[model samples]
Target: MLLFDLDNTLFPFRQYWEEANRTTFTSSPLTNGLSYDAFLPLLKMFDEELWPLHVKEAITLNELRVERFIRTMHALGRSVNKEQSQHYFEAFMENLLSSITMDEELRDFLDKLQQSYTLAILTNGKEKEQWRKIIQLNLTSVIPFEHIFISEDIGYDKPDPRAFQHVLKTLNVEARSATYIGDSWTHDIQGSIGVGMNAIWITPRQASSINENLHLSRTIYDIEPCLFHLNRTTTIT
Candidate 1:
């Protein structure tokens, strides 16, 4: 069985996320409540200072989305009322979904892998937005819909044992028989390993530092090469 992370694992999430954020700030009503000129600077502050704090505690992606908007508005001297915050958060998320782009090779690889294994997506994002991305990318055409698990739906994010356990239980697979592939060392690799599943670290960025714990599993820059090796080795086994 194969479990995959959605964002940076299958697509260049950071690149597309930055573009989406910019588009939201420019076009969405989320920025209308604040001083438009100061929104970008506030976003920078939220991304650099506030986000890192949340990430360390293994916050759910939905909470992060809401918190980022609330904090950004507060930093910009705007109101942070819960109702208004929710509105902007929804708008911001909708904008982000419209900006997703999948890696071209990912589709082909997933199609092949699906024929031999029970494939699933274990992603940490809002249910609506994550589903939107999956549909937009046509991932459902290859991957089963029931196998998609989003943090918002499960109320648990990666790096948390509960999330990995949920997937194992649902798939009826022992941890040893399942393999997790994701980009983040903290969330994807460390989290999956903690639950006793094999892990593959997809290091898209060249300058990323290796996590000492992931030294035994496969690491690759591209999905095609990793899939090729998995096919060959699993066949041999």
Candidate 2:
């Protein structure tokens, strides 16, 4: 069986993120002559810092989603009204949430894999947001929604052993018989490995110092060799 992460693993997430942000932030009261150049730095800070805070419960996900706009506006010496903030937030999320495009080649690769093994998506994120991307990417066309597991719906996030265990139990597969693939280091690599499952990192990002010893693949289309090794190794064991 193969389990996967949603963002950055299945599609070109950075391109979509840039597209969504540019579209949503360039209009209305949100930008008071705020150059995209100025906006870029704020965007990076908010995502890198706030996300970890959201994960740690320092703030709710909803707060994490919208507060960055408020902070950015404030930093730019502009006072944003609630209505304006709300509009910007809604537009940004709509774009971000709906931005994932299904990779036809990935679907083809998965089609071949499904013929031999069970494939499931075990991603960490809010339920609606995750499901939206799943549908947006047309993932259900190949894998059933029933096989896709989201962290919020499961009441646990990855890197938590229980999260991985739940998916394995639901799939009726032993941990060693399954492999987890994702971009996040803690959540996908160490998390799955910590639970007794091998992991294939959708890389070139070395998530940890130990990454040198871990299985790695550059792009979604570049996973054939990894999949082959995984299959052969499992068969041997």
Candidate 3:
């Protein structure tokens, strides 16, 4: 069995993100002529900074959505009311959802993998948002609907052992028999490892000193060799 992460794993997430931001920023007068290049990092910074609080339940989803925009605008020396922030959020989401599309390369890859493996997606995100993304990408045609697992639906997020365990139990897949593939090191790599499942890390970043020993694939398509080794190792053990 092969399990995968959603964002940045099945698709080129950063590229889509930039496209979404560019569309939204250019269409909005609220941005006050701010360039997408400048707006992207400021908004991304807050999203990353506040995401932990949302995951820990320190803040509600609505609060996280609104606050990120408020902080981004504030950083640019602009005062934004809650209503204005919500407007930005809604517009950005609309643009994002509309801009999301799967390329032929990823589609063909998943199609071929589906022929040989029982594929599943275990991802961390709001249920509605994640499902919309999957649908937008037309994943249902390739991956079974029941195989998609969302953190919100499972009542736990990635990096939580319960989340991984829940999926394994639901699918009746033993830890050793399943291999997880994802981009996040902490959430996908460590989480799967904690459950005794094999994992392939998808990262384009150069290996750092702290992670010199682990093999990393620059793209999801680069995992064929790793998968071969893992399957062989699993069979041997």
Candidate 4:
């Protein structure tokens, strides 16, 4: 079984995020007089700062979504009411979701992988938005609906051993029989490793130390070599 992360692993999430922000902010009157460049950093900073709190259930998803934009506008010397903040957020999300489309190369790669493995998605996000992204990416054509697991639905987020263990139990697979591929080292890699599953780290960041399972992929398209490495390791073991 092959478990995958939705955002950065399945698609270029950071690229999509930047493009979406640029498109939305540049076109929207809501951002008038605010430099998109300046607003973007503040938006990202607050998101990074507040995301852990969201994951820990310290705040509601709606609060996290609206607060980031509110803080960004405040930093830019603008005030926004809740309605305005929500309007801006919805606009940005629509732009972001609309920008997702599966290219032929990715579709083809997933098609081939589906032939040999039971592919599934394990992601951390609100259920509705995540489903919207899945539909936008056209992932249902390749990955089955039931195989997709959201942390919101599971009640346990990534980096938690229980989440991985739940997937393994539900799938009736031993930990050793599963392999997880994702970009986040703390969440995806460590979570799967904690539960004794094999992991492929899909990252561009330089590793502080080298190890057999730590494969730095430039893109998800580069995953073939990492899978090959895993196969070799399995055979040798």
Q: Any residue pairs clashing in model 2, and if so which?
A: none
**Model 3 per-residue lDDT at 126:** 86
Cα misplacement distance, residue 4 of candidate 2 (Å): 0.8
What's the lDDT for candidate 1? 0.72
RMSD, candidate 1, Å: 4.5
What is candidate 3's CA lDDT for residue 151? 93
For each candidate in turn, the TM-score is: 0.73, 0.90, 0.90, 0.90
Q: Cα deviation in Å at residue 40, candidate 2?
A: 1.6
Ranked by lDDT from best down, the candidates are 3, 4, 2, 1
Global Cα RMSD, each model: 4.5, 2.8, 2.9, 2.5
Per residue, candidate 1 scores C-alpha lDDT tens digits across 36-101 of 567766766666666676767666445666677788787776657667767766666677777665
Each model's lDDT comes to 0.72, 0.79, 0.83, 0.83
Model 2, runs deviating above 4 Å: 81-83, 205-213
Query: Which 10 successive residues of model 2 have the least lDDT summed?
Result: 205-214
lDDT tens digits, residues 206-229, model 4?
522245655566667777776777
